[model samples]
Target chain A: DTAVSQTPKYLVTQMGNDKSIKCEQNLGHDTMYWYKQDSKKFLKIMFSYNNKELIINETVPNRFSPKSPDKAHLNLHINSLELGDSAVYFCASSQVGKRQYFGPGTRLTVT
Target chain B: TQLLEQSPQFLSIQEGENLTVYCNSSSVFSSLQWYRQEPGEGPVLLVTVVTGGEVKKLKRLTFQFGDARKDSSLHITAAQPGDTGLYLCAGGDSGGGADGLTFGKGTHLIIQP
Candidate 1:
């Protein structure tokens, strides 16, 4: 079984459109995070949620919103997508003071 | 943001060779972690070092945390072709409201047979 899972492995959309990527973890972890990996392969933290509480906003734009309905799910919704947003978005989970486990990643392409 | 800098962004070596990758930072980290990622996948945790001047080994791979807790190194001995991947190092906790682990740009290692 996959410890961490993400929906829509690939996404392609036009600029100004809105999209959402969903993430789920079966590892029973209390913390989940969203990260963006640019073409240069730099993984930047975007948002983090622990037990459905928003933490670690990373100064992300208002257009980028993350919602965690529960400890096991975290979803990222992007409004007015820009071409610069084209990159791989990853979801990761970890227990307190533990190593993170990542999902397969959602590749987003904005035209 | 705490920044982690990784040296030699890219490296290619033949099988049986040994190499070391460095990850440095200005701010001290409560803990440090190393991960390996392949194309079309997310990073896989290799190890985590929490103490200064700590060293941990996994088979032929050895990880070391700097005495200052601001840097780390990964050394692989007798690298095999299967070891080819993007290696990333992250520092600090991924917890606390609005604070996340700072990651290095990553080193792309290519091992050839």
Candidate 2:
């Protein structure tokens, strides 16, 4: 079974459209995170949730919100997406301070 | 502010050639991780180095952490086309607790046959 998985392997929408990406992990980890990879392939942490509570929220804009309904799931919702938000979003999970497992990723493109 | 700075934004070399990639940082980290990402896929963990001046080998790939824990290196011998991918280095706190890692921009490598 895939340890980590994300929905919408690819997404294309208008600049003002809103979209949501879902992620799930079966690794039974306590901490889950979301990362954004820009056109330059530079990865940056967006948000982190531990046991359904927000642990870290980077300097990302307020339009990007993360919700964790349970320990195994973390979803990202974007409101009025802009062209700058066109990038790959990755979901990762880890147990405590151990190495993290990353999902295949969701590629979002705003036209 | 990217904590880790990786050298050689892009590299393309012939097979069988040897190359090394460097990851540098100004602040110290408790442990550093190296990840390789292929096209259309998420980055996968290649290895993790915890101690200063420590060296670990995985097949032909040699990973070394600097003495100050502020740098790391990845050396590949006899590069093959299958080795083509994006390499990223990340730094994390020494506490080894709940925290996210700071990643480098990543080095895109292409090995031609």
Candidate 3:
């Protein structure tokens, strides 16, 4: 069974459109995070949630928002997506003192 | 802003060769981790070092944390074709604000058989 899973393995949308990616973890972890990997392959943390509470918000733009309905789910919503928003998004989950487990990742293409 | 800078952005070597990757940062960290990522997949944790000057070994891979906790290194002995992947180093601070990890850009390693 997949420990962490993300919906829509690939997304292609037009600019100025809003889109959402869903992530769920079955490892019963309390912490979840969203990371963005750009064209240059630089991975950066965008947001983090612990027990359904927002814990970390990086320097990401206000257009990017993350919501956690529970300890097992974290979703990312992008508003008015721009061309620069094209990148791979990964969802990960971890316990307080354990290694983080990641999903397959969703490749977002903002055309 | 806290950042981890990795050296040798790309490395290509023949099978059975040895290599080392370095990750450096100006800021001190409470713990450092090494992860390997295959194409189209998220990174998988290989090891974590919490103490300054700590060294850990996994099979043919050896990881070392700097004495000042500002740098780390991963040495792979006798690398094989299956070991080809992107290596990333992440730093975590003890102060409990975000507990979020700062990751390096990563080193892409290619092993040819």
Point to the candidate with the largest DockQ: 2
Q: Give the range of the ten consecutive residues with the poorest summed lDDT in model 2 chain A.
A: A49-58
What lDDT score is found at residue B85 in candidate 3?
94
Residue B107's lDDT in candidate 1? 97
Candidate 1 chain A vs. true chain A: TM-score? 0.95
* TM-score of model number 2: 0.97
Backbone clash pairs for candidate 2 read none
True contacts kept of each: 0.71, 0.78, 0.61
C-alpha lDDT (0 to 100) for residue A73 of candidate 2: 91
Poorly placed runs, candidate 2 (over 4 Å):
none
Write the residue-wise lDDT of candidate 3 on A19-64 in tens digits: 9999999998888889999988888888888765676555789999
lDDT of 2 by residue, B41-90 (tens): 99999999999999999999999999999999999999999999999999
**Which residue pairs overlap in candidate 1's backbone?**
A56-B97, A56-B98
List the candidate 3 regions with Cα displacement exceeding 4 Å: A56-58, B96-98
Q: Model 1 over residues A64-101: C-alpha lDDT tens digits?
A: 99988777899999999999999999999888556688
* Rank ordering of all candidates by lDDT, starting from the highest: 2, 1, 3
Model 3, A110: alpha-carbon shift in Å?
Answer: 0.7
**What is the TM-score of each predicted model, taking all chains together?**
0.95, 0.97, 0.95
Question: RMSD of each candidate?
Answer: 1.6, 1.2, 1.3
**Evaluation by DockQ, superior candidate among 2 and 3:** 2
Which of the predicted structures, 2 or 3, would earn the higher lDDT when compared with the native? 2
